[model samples]
Target: MKKKTFNVLLLSVLLSAFTIACTKDIDFNQIDDFEVTPVIESSLIFLDEPANQFLEDGVEISSVQDSVLVEIFKDAFIKEHLVKAEFVFETTNSINRGIELRIDFLTDSNIQLHSFSFAVEASSTNTPTIFNYTEVFENNTLESLFETGKLLFTLNLKPGPVINENTPGSIKLKSKGIFFLNIDNTL
Candidate 1:
């Protein structure tokens, strides 16, 4: 009985020492820095009287197919791994006419990455009706967006009729985007 008791006590001390030796401190130095890009904003106006209101530089209009392509940002994103992205689109309607808007994001190669659609209420009293939309992207999904290089915006407008032909209404769209980047030490 005495010998058995001694063996058990020795086994307990050895087991405790082995457990303490296996534990180590965790290191969190893998993340290097966080960077934020400046806000990018753009706007476009659509008029009924002029018919082709999107004829300015950086704006393209196709009357035959009723389409509009506007380059909102040219190489706007920096060369860093994107951690998060937030985009806000605000539409102000002063044209007494409702419109359906289709917004597309394209890569430098003109490949579309994503698209969104929204509707704007008509402004019958000349007061601007505003609508806001927000989107957030994170992690691996955001890294791919930065790899696309430059970003382009393609806008398609389907407008409703004017309340009064004498007093035609117009639409103006305002959009802004912000990016949060990270320089991962592992990268």
Candidate 2:
């Protein structure tokens, strides 16, 4: 009887210890931050690379004889491609000095001119065409910049004083690219 009692007691103690040890199954993987991290960051802008795009029609002065040569070809190419202008010249009562010439330009991204026109080469006659041009220029009294990359301007064809030295003064001014002409801001 005594032995049986002792054995039973020992068995019971052992069972208890085993149960206690088995109940805890925690091993959280030594988690300090607990995983789940997602943070990434990596980030440039300065521009002026417009080499040329606004040369829609810069030097259009087929040819003019007088009226200050249309204010000197509107001060060389449509008054610097003004933000306003619409002149359509056409005179032939006897050609006292004013032939047909059309203009409609308003350049500089604001975009207003799609295809302006201008030509007058008839100092006496003989210029069906060939003084290519667009219109718009800058530099008045200093500091003019029509993008200043190169949109040259100026069409000085004079027969205005009625001179006869060849009188057929043909005006000219082609533009597409390249500038820096007659550096005089009208000063």
Candidate 3:
């Protein structure tokens, strides 16, 4: 009976100590200063065209053009949070002709806002030649980027050996966009 009484008193003391434990005050306002910077990478464009695609009826087609919708800019949240953007392009050519690429940023009503161009050298051997280019948008350009609704790409072939239906090489292009965002709760 004495041992049982001692065990009950020990349990009561432990419970009482836990109930009276002290805790420091917490400041919920600290969350107002929290901020986050995030980087996002996404594939923007790709193309693989056989040499013969540049020829039609034994005549070389000097240029070919295409466009894609920039859907991410349609989001208001993305526009507000985005601080910078970068576009990376890689092109590999196995054809015997150098090429020039023209890129244009346009709005919903087909108004051009910005344009840039780059050139890719021709490959002399069966091994393909690779070219890389990067375009960055920030500060004053960021506002124009937010207004972009579409991108136009034009590929122009340089004069060289003629390519026919039986040509043995192709030109390939791959590109991506990197986005930088700053999100602050205080905003």
Candidate 4:
């Protein structure tokens, strides 16, 4: 009986040791696999979104400003509508910023001449000094450049530099405060 009890005790101890030996703790620090890809959307089905509008003397318009109205539709611009002109300058004298112009259409019976004039007054802002043009706006010191009655800075602006030293940014305009001739039908 003593021997059998000793044998049973030994067997129990050995089984416990075996179980403890089988138990283990494991640790991991690395993921097994991974992948990456880029997303692209080319469907032209978006709601009214702001265009990255910009202006330049001669470059991409997107490099100018944000949400410019005058650029997309200059020829068909209406009166009382506000718009922005763009300027891209890689030089020290940069006047390509904040060039705001107002448009007014005249009609004989409802139309002005195809050729109307405008005025360009120097704003209280830090406008660069305008140099020489006509005897009227010469001396390069336009304390009030350039004044005409009817319009503000108007003279056939297409693409490219509007004025230079010789032209002096002429304010093609009428002497009277009102530039557009409202044609009365009583001829």
Give the winner by lDDT: 3
lDDT of 3 by residue, 132-167 (tens): 999999989987788899999999998888778887
Candidate 1 vs candidate 3: the TM-score winner is: 3
lDDT of 2 by residue, 1-187 (tens): 9999999999999999988875666787556434332222111011111111111244333342221111123354423333322222222211113334443232333233233345444433433333333343334421233222222122233233332323333322222222333322332
Ranked by lDDT from best down, the candidates are 3, 1, 2, 4
Model 4: CA > 4 A from native: 1-105, 113-115, 118-158, 161-187
In candidate 1, residue 126 scores what lDDT?
65
User: Worst lDDT window (10 residues) for model 4?
Assistant: 84-93
Candidate 4 vs. true structure, TM-score:
0.16
**Lowest summed lDDT window (length 10), candidate 1:** 58-67
TM-score leader: 3
List the candidate 2 regions with Cα displacement exceeding 4 Å: 1-88, 92-102, 109-112, 116-164, 168-187
Q: What are the TM-scores, per candidate, against the unseen true structure?
A: 0.51, 0.17, 0.84, 0.16
75 Cα displacement, candidate 4 (Å): 31
Model 3: lDDT equals 0.90
Give per-residue CA lDDT, model 4, range 1-187, as digits (tens). 9999999999999999998886555544223232222222122111121111221443334222111112222222211121211111111112332232323222323233222222233423334423221112223322122221221222222243433332222211212111111122222
Which lDDT tens digits does candidate 1 get at residues 1-187?
Answer: 9999999999999998998886666666534543334443333333333223534343434221223343432234344444567767777767555666665555666677766667777776768778877767676555455545344444444454423324544566566666665544544
